[model samples]
Target: MEPRWLSQDEQESWLPFAAMLIKLPAALDAQLQRDADITHFEYLVLARLSMIRDRTLRMSELASVVSASLSRLSHVVKRLEQRGWVRRAPCPENGRFTNAILTEAGWEKVVATAPGHVEEVRRLVVDALSESELRQLREISSRVLQRIDPDAGTW
Candidate 1:
């Protein structure tokens, strides 16, 4: 079968998007590293846990939420544990599965880090877009995500 290729207009659209995929993570990581002494992914793991009701989640579920592998999450969690920011234990409901729980320190870390992080996000993304462009970006990203994985739910 012949492969379908991007047309000129499609290529023009995709190039900037592709560059953003490369640049944005580095930019966010840089800010997080400089301000909080954490990587963006680490901050994400902490922030996501903070958002949950109990500040706990099963390892597998947390991995899915962060789009990470269990091994990677476990390693990060280990580092967090060393910092007294997170803890891990067998889930009470199912002993076979482990749960990651944010400690008081972890919550505090998120609280302290969030303002700077939010400011960076706002300055880089939100402030750069008009309201209409923001809506369009959201819609376009959602559509792309749906196409990539129809079963995936919003975060």
Candidate 2:
């Protein structure tokens, strides 16, 4: 068997793609930590929970939303729990499952942090692209995500 290799065009595209993957998260995290005292991942977890009617999600579902391991999500939620932003309890419907519930303070934190985060996101990524570019970016992201996790549901 011969080793498969990236062609020149593939290599060229990957360079910038990989760089953006590295740089974008760092930039987003810096803004989040400085303004909201939360990392981007934590913000994502909170944001996802906030959009639900109950502001709560089963722990396993949350791990999927954040694309995190169960262990990692548990650790992060514990930190949020200590801050009085979220609580973990056994699901009443199914004691086998744990639920992560956003507290009043967590909702307030999301409300406070969202506007600034939105502005920064627009300034950094959305504003830099045209309408067509935005659509193209979405398509590109979806294609890559499908390749990575075919069983994944919409987030």
Candidate 3:
């Protein structure tokens, strides 16, 4: 079957979106690296772990939450472990499972870094949009995410 080419308007919109996909992660990583000595992905993992009950989450659950493969998460977790930021323990309920727990030091690091990260987010994305535009952007993004991953589970 022949593919339908994008219209000019779609092309223009997609170009910026594609560029953003490529650039945003790099930019975010750079900022985190400068301020926290961590990659954006590592910060994300740490941040997610921080939010979970008991400041811990099962490895598989963490992988799913971060949309990362087990192997990928393992490597990242290993690095975090080295930094004294996280530790892995055998899950109490299931010996076969492991849980990633954010350490006190890790929590402190995240707490210290969060303000800078939030400022970066505001400066880079939020501040660029008007109040109405921000709302519309959130609605659009939520709809697109739901369509892309219908069974993505809870927010």
Candidate number achieving the greatest TM-score relative to the actual structure: 2
Model 3 spans with C-alpha error above 4 angstroms: 153-155
Which pairs of residues clash in candidate 1, taking residues 3 or more apart in a chain or in different chains? Answer: none
- Local distance difference test scores for all models: 0.95, 0.95, 0.93
Estimate the lDDT of model 3.
0.93
Q: Give the TM-score of candidate 3.
A: 0.92
Q: In terms of TM-score, how similar is model 1 to the real structure? A: 0.92
Locate the minimum summed-lDDT window of 10 residues in model 1.
146-155
Kindly provide the TM-score of model 2 when superposed on the true structure, using C-alpha atoms: 0.93
lDDT by residue (41-106, candidate 2, tens digit) is: 999999999999899899999998788999999999999999999999999888999999999999
List residue ranges in candidate 1 displaced over 4 A. Answer: 1-3
Model 3 C-alpha RMSD to native? 1.5
Model 3, 12-115: lDDT tens digits are 99999999989988888899999989999999999998887899999999999899999999999999999999999998888999999999999998998888
Better of 1 and 2 by TM-score: 2
Clash number for each model: 0, 0, 0
**For residues 26-118, could you state the per-residue lDDT of candidate 1 as single tens digits?**
999999999999989999999999999999999899999998999999999999999999999998787899999999999999999999999
